[model samples]
Target chain A: MIVTVTPNAALDVTYTVDSLVPDAVHRARDVRRRAGGKGVNVARVLHALGADVRAVVTAGGATGAEFAADLGAAGLPADLVPIDGETRRTTTVLSAVDGSVTLLNEPGPELSAAEWALLAERVRRREPEVLVCSGSLPPGAPPDGYARLLAGRTSVLDTSGAALLPGLAGRPAVVKPNLEELREVTGLDDPIAAAAELRKAGAGAVVVSLGADGLLAVTAAGTWHATPSKVLTGNSTGAGDAVVAALALGLCRREPWPEILRRAVALSGAAVLGPLAGDVDLAHYHRELAAVRVRPEGES
Target chain B: MIVTVTPNAALDVTYTVDSLVPDAVHRARDVRRRAGGKGVNVARVLHALGADVRAVVTAGGATGAEFAADLGAAGLPADLVPIDGETRRTTTVLSAVDGSVTLLNEPGPELSAAEWALLAERVRRREPEVLVCSGSLPPGAPPDGYARLLAGRTSVLDTSGAALLPGLAGRPAVVKPNLEELREVTGLDDPIAAAAELRKAGAGAVVVSLGADGLLAVTAAGTWHATPSKVLTGNSTGAGDAVVAALALGLCRREPWPEILRRAVALSGAAVLGPLAGDVDLAHYHRELAAVRVRPEGES
Candidate 1:
């Protein structure tokens, strides 16, 4: 069973409008909510891929109920810790014409130490085969909470900044950082150099996603690069989560690292073809996987 | 005593964010909910102005509970009819810097005939001093339902479209339409011409709320133009509703037409400061009343 922990979970809402006019009244045509956090996103994707997963997070008030509804609707089993403050909500406004998305993010309710302890207890109760920690650390939480959550085992850590810095000390099985985050973490202009620096900072292996450009890796299997195959994009909301799921699967199944990168790229491409988040077609994934290019070091 | 009826009330939720992104994840920084609908706004403003006011509406489920809580918090009495469906929610997204608002309106649950019957029964029992009907006709309801709910010599009908057409035929004491809607109803671009046409159509009197411009009225006394002292602008979510509340109050007290529009403009100006619909500052309203200007015109 895969266990994903979202320390700062949110009820995500999306609004569809013709155009956003600042300081003007706009009538939104649509509103949608989903339980979100990096860990929750990873668990949902893995579950869609036929993996047994448990989504754990803390919540409160009506916003909390919304989070549960979102998870239940997505077919993910969830265990949530209750709190006094209402759970936070995230709003996204999508353009009705081209589907361009804008995001407004909230810092979220501050969690008490008791709540953190409660979440840790919930985690201990449901021992997951593979543990995934996602999103930022909520304020008041110790920086090393992610490392402690994994208990030094081979875990998949998908995060950046404060959590990423301290979380890297635990040396998770593999760390997945997007290209920008990799640069932010390592202060390097080059993606390859960033991945190497992150690996040096105690991340056992690093898979830095480069979006449309593809994937880069640095691990025991050696440095390698895989470019994504051409696939029509529909929505990219959960494609990154899909890549994380594919990478975790590859490590757990002990598949070859290069093949894992190939699969990750294909799965993400497949994800972009689906309408809503966490939706991917395995049929498309397999078809795209064969066309991926894996270039070894010094290939050029 | 002024009583306002909202057949389809809502828990208005406003989300404050930096920007909106579609299909992508965004977080909301602030969340606020209030009892909403045109009638509710009227009653809220009347209550703020020290008038004896009662708000009669239907509320249900958890959102309904929230609606009642907000009404209680605001120091207003709720003669709310309960329904099986939860009270509908209206979401508005506002940008903090720009003060721009976006509205996502939900067509509330269909009001069963039983619910409609219940609201009518409540009105009969109360027989308010000045009954004010506001807001759009919900689905599964006839526009003339407002006329069916209240029948008296002094009732005020402030509605549009179907509600306006049928309720006007019922010969309510007063009807308030903005200039644009007046054109749609009477096919007259001229205010005086439109007022005569509505009177011919059976309305006893008509008041045209011209927003920042001011109020135009054709009453039993004479034709009068009430112009506001200044445009103190901010958020104008419920300025019209505030004007309606003051109108109902004036008719109830039998205030001289001049004092009526003066107080109306003052109250309407105060409403411009509130973020939600129908909110007004009593102090602001009182301060501006002394400066309100009314000019009598040639009319019936």
Candidate 2:
């Protein structure tokens, strides 16, 4: 089964408020709770795409129970490793009037050495077809700890920070970062130049996601750039996760570069229009995929 | 003893983030959990004011446990009536960058008939000198619910909506509402006119809080207005509760009308700068109270 690992996951809560005022009382109009984290986000999108995937995550306390309850409510495949402190609760406040979103993320419960070891052992036991480690490292976790688990697997590293740099030391199937993150990672502003730097720096392949513009991929075969059919406007909360989800599925199916890039762009575009983060409009995504265009980086 | 009846108390969780981007992930710099609800706030603030107060409220499940835990951590007196569903949690996302606050309020767990009876019985048994029924009315509770229980005692009503209307109909010793809420209750924009309407409508006495402008009290003796020595700039999350807290304490001591109003305004002004809603800066409040001035409404 397709597997995803989220070292730290959370109970995601979204609130709708009439207005937000500084240090004042506000009456919330509505609220929705779900399970969230980068890797968990990727797995959710994959599940939405009708892909059978197993999610491996760490949680603790009543908040962990909240995560499990939310995941169970969604019918997602979960292999949650219980720990000590309560799992964190991440809040998203959606101001519908102005379409402004505020995120209040809790640093998830800290993981002990024993819990981390148990997680790694659990991953070792499940020979997942494709292992995607996405998002930030939780507190108490070593930066490259996620990458070390990719030793015998075809892992996709899609996180930023000291973690991403160290993870790149061990070449993974692909590492997807946006233009800004690419600039931060390789100190190159131009997409082509940045992709080149990543390839040279040891990444097996580099897929640089450019919001609104689309995605660019560089590999041994060559380079390709793909753009969505239309610039759809909506929340872009989980667009990157959608791209990662499609990229992993495409890798598993051995889809050609052009098809993979086109599909990923459409999926991300659909995700931008979804109300929930990491959720894509399947019909719209499928319809838009056929219209996505991929041009060979217009170079040799 | 000061008795606070929080029929609809809550567990307040505050998450502070750098910026709030709706439906996106945010990293909270601080997370503070505390016991909340109007009555609970009154209990806490009153306790801080040297009044021995017992928080008599209902609770259930983990949410209730956490609510009780917060009270325990603060070293406040409490008598939590156990029930079925988990207590509700009120989440506030405070943006660290701008200090903007957003609230996500949950409809608290429904209390069974047995639970309601138990609460009423508890109030009947204690009969503290001054009783405060503040905040929202819990679900499954009738509108006149609290008023019926605190029947003969000198009760102060600090609430709005159906609960406030019914409590007023029962002739509570004192009722306090901000100018706007007083308007909502009396359908008049004028504070004095609104307070007069309430006094005529079965309310024993009416205290209409006008922020910055000050506090106006209408009683059998006469109507008087008390203004703080200085208007300080700060949040007013629990300013009204602080007023009620000061009132509860002053009334228990049988302080004169304008003196009660003076003390209430000073405490409320100090509360504007306090961390927790309804909390007052003890030193500031005391110092400011000494200089608080009360003016006759007209030949009082």
Candidate 3:
């Protein structure tokens, strides 16, 4: 089983409004709330694809209860570590008029040293074949939070900034960072250079998600660039999580690097077609998979 | 004892940001949540002033639990009727850059017929000396929800549209509507004419809140206009609720019409000086009370 760890889980709320106007009052036409976080989304995608996956998350207060309930209702396997601080929420306001989206993210609750240890212990107890660590660390958490969970185990690390560099110490099997995150960490605009920097730092393989441009992979086997034939238009919030899910699945199944890259690109494109993050159209995924093109980095 | 009824209660959330720009993502600098509804505000004000007040509100799901916890923390006396539908939340985004405020209100959950009856039964069991009905009725709720609660009891009614006109049939001791609501319900531009129309519709007295201009009251005692001597600037979201609170207090104390009008205007102004609804600066209230001006309508 693949175990996904979400250090900072959130209750994602979506408010649909007629139009979004700054400095004005709006009455939401509809409100939808669900469990969300990078690792949670990754696990959701894996579960939807009928993969063996379990999510480990930190939960607290009323919002946490709601998040846990939603996860249970979705029939996603999860282990929740209780904490004192209330869980945070990420609100998305979708404007019906122009289909524009505005996001307001609350910095999640600070985890005490004891709380962090508890969460780490929970993940360790699971003893899964593959461990996927995703999302931001709450305030006061050790920067090497994901690295602490690695313990020389096979892992996929997806995070940014301070948390990103420290996790390299554990030498995760795959490190996935979006293009912007790669530039921020490596101070390199070129995807090839940035991916190389992460691989050198300790990553067995580095995958740089390039949004609609697709995925660029730098692995021990070889460097390859994968792209979907058609650009899909929809919410791109969970596209990266989908890519991480695909990569984890590929690693678990021992797929070749080229095949893994192709699946990652196809899954990422399909995620964009979903209205919310961590969701994808199965039919779209299959169609895109056949059309995905994977070639060596130097190829035209 | 004054019993304040909030048919549609909310978890009011405020998010403070550096600036508010449409179609852009924001990371909230601060977040504050509290129990809210027009009646809840009125009850809070009364409790703060050391008056005997109990808030009757409908609550359900996770949001309701949070709301109830907030009320308990605030030490406000309340009766929460349990329901299956989750409580709604009203989010206010405050921009630190320009002090511009934006509001997003979720339409609260619809009440089942059984739930509505239970709520009414709970209120009737309290046998309050003075009943105060405030805020909008939830979807599927009876239009005359406030009227049904009035069983020849001394009451103060503050609502709009269909709810406003129907409550008058129960002959509430006072009906308070802001200028905009007055026009919508009575279709009259002149506050004096509209106030009179409401009295004719069976309201014992009609008080029309005119924002910075203060209040216009038409009663069996006399016609009067009251205004604060000087304008106070702050958030005006809960100013009307403050006016209703003062009116309920005055009625409970058997105060004269002129004295009550003066207090209402002063309280309303004081509420504006507060950062949040149901909050008042005691110093500001005392100062404004002494400076409030009240006169017969003809003199004005």
Candidate 4:
């Protein structure tokens, strides 16, 4: 089974409004809520692909109870490690007037050292074939928390900021960072150079996401570029998680780099067309999978 | 114990942010949450004053569970009636830069006829010294829901719109409406004239809140006006609820018209000095109570 870990989980709530007037009251036309965190999203995508997946999350307080209840109601498998701090909620206000999204993310609850230790123990017991660690670390969690969780397993890491900086030292099988994250990590505007820097820093493979342009994959097998035949646009909130899910599944099946890149690009494209993160339109995914082009960097 | 009923209860969440920019991400520095509604706020204020008080509220789903937990944590007494729909949440975004509060209130969950009957039964069992039915009615609940609950139990009605219009016909011992609500109910811009119209509509007494101007009481005993010594400026979100609480207590003690207006004005003003709704600065309340001035309209 593919195992994913989310250190800072959230209940993501989306409210659709006719218009958003600053400093004025807004009555939402529609409201939707889901269990959210990068790793949780990744696991959700993998599960939707008919893969065996389990998610490990830290939960506490009333919000935590609600988060767990939401996951249970969705029939998602999770291993919850109790903590003392209450989980946070992230609210996204979608203004239909101009198609703008306003995000309000709470700083997640802080974790005690003992709580981190418990989380580490829980991950160890899972015995995952392809382990994936994603999302931001809770306050007070060590910057290298993901690195320690790696422990030389066949793992993928998808995070940014201090966690990503220190985690690069403990090389995972694959590292995925979007364009902005790459700039933050390497202080370079060039994506290729930043990917190379990450590769040199012990990452076995480096995959850099370039938003609408698609993704670049650099590995010992050789560098590859993959893109969908047509651009699909909706809410691209969880497109990156779709890519990570694809990569983890590919690792579990021991797929070739070219095939993996093609699937990742197609799935990520399909995710954008879907309503929420971690969900892909099966029809669009199949169509895009056939049209996705992946080849050596020099060929394209 | 004084009892309060809230047909539409809410989980009130406050987020303190550096500044609010429309359609942009806001990272909150601090967050606070509590149980809230007009009647809930009244009960909270009365409870804080060491008075025997119990709040009866409609609750459902995870958010409802959290609302009850918050009340329990605060050591407030409550009787929660179950419903099928989830309770709503009201968010207040406080911008530190300009001290502005942006309110976002969700239309509360709809109540089935059975749920409303169950709530009414729960309130009846409480057998309170003085009953208070406050706030807006949920969708699907009858506009005269508070009128039906009153049942001539020496109750006070604090609501607006259609709910207030029919509720006044129940002949509540007191009907507390702010200046705006009085105008909306009677279609009269004059506060005194609007209050007089309400009194003529079977209401025993009419109290109109005038915000910074103070409060006006139109009762069978005599017309009176009460004003605080100075205007306390801060968050006035719960000032009116405090006035309702004071009125309920005064009705229970059978206080005279002038003393009741004086205490209600002071307590309402003191509520503005507190950081949150349902809380008043005790020192401010005492000082303002002593300095409060009350006089007959024509005798002055």
lDDT of 1 by residue, B1-300 (tens): 678889878888777766544444445677677888888999988887678889898898777888988988888876989888777777677666656655666567678888888888887777788899887777667668977765665778877766787787667778889888789887889998998888887788898998788999898779998888888766666788888888899889988889889988898888887766777877888888998888987532
Model 2: lDDT of residue B191: 79
lDDT of 2 by residue, B7-100 (tens): 7788887776776654455677778788888788888888887788898988888778888888898899888888797787787666657655
- Highest TM-score against the true fold, candidate: 2
Please give the RMSD of candidate 4 to the true structure: 4.5
Q: Between which residue pairs do clashes occur in model 3?
A: none
Native-referenced TM-scores of chain A, all candidate models: 0.93, 0.94, 0.96, 0.96
Best by DockQ: 3
Q: Model 4: per-residue lDDT, tens digit, B43-160?
A: 9889878889999998898789889888899898899998999999877777778766666677888999999999989888988889999988999998778788886789899988
Docking quality tier of candidate 4?
Answer: acceptable
For each candidate, the alpha-carbon lDDT, in order, equals: 0.79, 0.81, 0.89, 0.86
Query: Where's the lowest-lDDT run of ten residues in candidate 2 chain A?
Result: A18-27
State residue B110's C-alpha deviation in candidate 1, in Å.
Answer: 2.4
Error of 1 at A181 (Å): 4.8
Report residue A160 deviation for candidate 4 (angstroms).
2.9
Predict model 1's lDDT versus the native. Answer: 0.79
In model 2, which regions exceed 4 Å deviation?
Answer: A19-24, A179-189, A218-222, A231-235, A272-275, A297-300, B19-25, B95-102, B233-235, B297-300
Candidate 2: what lDDT? 0.81
Instruction: Report the number of clashing residue pairs per model.
Output: 14, 7, 0, 0
Fnat across every predicted model, in order: 0.61, 0.67, 0.85, 0.71
